[model samples]
Target: MIAIDINKRIGRGPGSFRLQVKTVFQFNSVTRILGPSGVGKSTLLKILAGFITPDSGLIKFGDAVWFDSQIKYSKMVQERNVGFVFQDYALFPNMTVAQHLHYGSDNADYINQLLELGELTSLKERLPRQLSGGQQQRLAILRALSTKPKLLLMDEPFAALDSALKIRIMERLKSLFEEQQTTVLMVTHQDQEWEHPKNQIFNLLSQED
Candidate 1:
């Protein structure tokens, strides 16, 4: 189980917002954080991922204490077994798709499986700049999964794809998650995106209740 008990102040000047997440996320399930644009949804995910520190509270993932403000114990982002996929699809423009997958792991068989699962085999030689937006997004996700992380965090992963492509990718993701059993925490503003099976949806703004 991943338990996040935190309270932090965010933003600048008079337009700042306060973020408080005193909740527990179960294991091996997809938890979708739903809210408006500037409601600190991504910030909460960042804190959980150990990219941001809170003024007070503790974060425990199973037996590991990832962060504890009272004790001043905080793990680095790399130390946590997390796979993060940003909304913009952060990929090296000069590197080929094959190179990206290989960079995460040296296992050839795993790389081949990722290529097949992501439908990226055909585009292995293509660079990020050469691929379409959706293709780039697929590559980004594949790269993250290559790390074999216990927890996967995605921010608006399907925002750049069309509805048809989104549906197809979502199906593929469901299969991949089932096969790997990786815990996923995804943030999205669209309600229709969280209709997948076995997913727990939580509205961030309503979290206080």
Candidate 2:
């Protein structure tokens, strides 16, 4: 299981607040971190992903210790083997769809499966600029998944997609996650977006209590 126990302080301005979060995120299931804007959802995810360090407490994934403030030990983001998909679907403008997937892994079979899963088999040669917003989002997700990461961290992954496409992509992601049994931790402002029973939804507001 992926266990998290951390207290972080962010935003140097007067609006900043101490983001104290502690929770155990189970593996082999999707965990939705639901909250309103400015709730430090992304901050928490970043800490877990090793993009940022916690001021105190510890974080562990199964037998591995990702972070331990008391021990003064912290792993680098890349060393954590965590995949991240940002809100804007951070794709390289110069890279083709196939290139992005190849960056994740050299396995041709895995790349082909991801391309088929994202429905981008026809657009493999196209650059990010050539694809639609929804297509870009799918490609971004596929690239992350292709890495075969132990944990996937997503920040508002579907915020850029339209309603129809969001639903379709969500369905595909759910199916793929189940098939792969990859652990996912996603932050979303929309509460209804994670209505699927397979996912364990946890509101940050409730988590604070």
Candidate 3:
């Protein structure tokens, strides 16, 4: 399990609010963050991903200390063994689908499996610019999943896909996560996205209650 008890004052002037978050993320489970916009959902994900530093507090994952403000220790992003899926589907402009999948992994068998899972087998040679919005989203997801990360952090991961396609991929994605035993923390605004009983939910605003 991972725990985060931190505070960061976001923005400035009258518009800013201190993002005070204290929560525990269970290991080998999917936790969906739920809250209104500007409630620090994505900010919380960034903190866990090591892209942002918390002004105070500590973050511990099992026996590893990811961040401890008092001690001035912060684990590097790559060393944290975490995968991040950006909301904007950060795909390479020049790389094809195959190249993206093969970026970190040379396991052709595993690459094929992810391609099939994402229904991108036929589009493997296509670049991000050539693919549709939904296809680009799938490619982004596959790139992250190909790593088989210890923990995956996603921000509105399914925003581009239609409802039917979202459900279809999510079903297989859940199975893959289970097989890999990957811990996931996702920020979602859609109610039906990964709406399963097994997943945990967190309301940021009510986190202190």
Best by TM-score: 3
> Candidate 2 or 3, higher lDDT?
3
State TM-scores per candidate.
Answer: 0.92, 0.90, 0.94
Error of 1 at 115 (Å): 1.8
Alpha-carbon local distance difference test for all models: 0.85, 0.83, 0.89
Candidate 3, superposed: residue stretches over 4 Å from native: 191-197, 206-209
> How accurate locally is residue 122 in candidate 3, as Cα lDDT from 0 to 100?
100
RMSD of 3: 2.0
Q: Across residues 43-76, which tens digit of lDDT does each residue of candidate 3 receive?
A: 9989999999999999999889999999999999
> Candidate 2: misplaced stretches above 4 Å?
191-198, 206-209
Between the candidate structures 1 and 2, which one is better when assessed by lDDT? 1
Decreasing lDDT order of the candidates:
3, 1, 2
> Which lDDT tens digits does candidate 1 get at residues 1-209?
98988988886677787888888888888988888778888888888788889989999999999998888999998889798888888898888999998888899999998888777898899999999988898898889898888899998877777888778777777778888889999997674755656778878883321
Q: Which regions of candidate 1 are displaced past 4 Å?
A: 191-198, 206-209
- Give the per-residue Cα lDDT of candidate 2 at 17: 73
- Candidate 3, overall lDDT? 0.89
- Measured by lDDT, the strongest candidate is 3
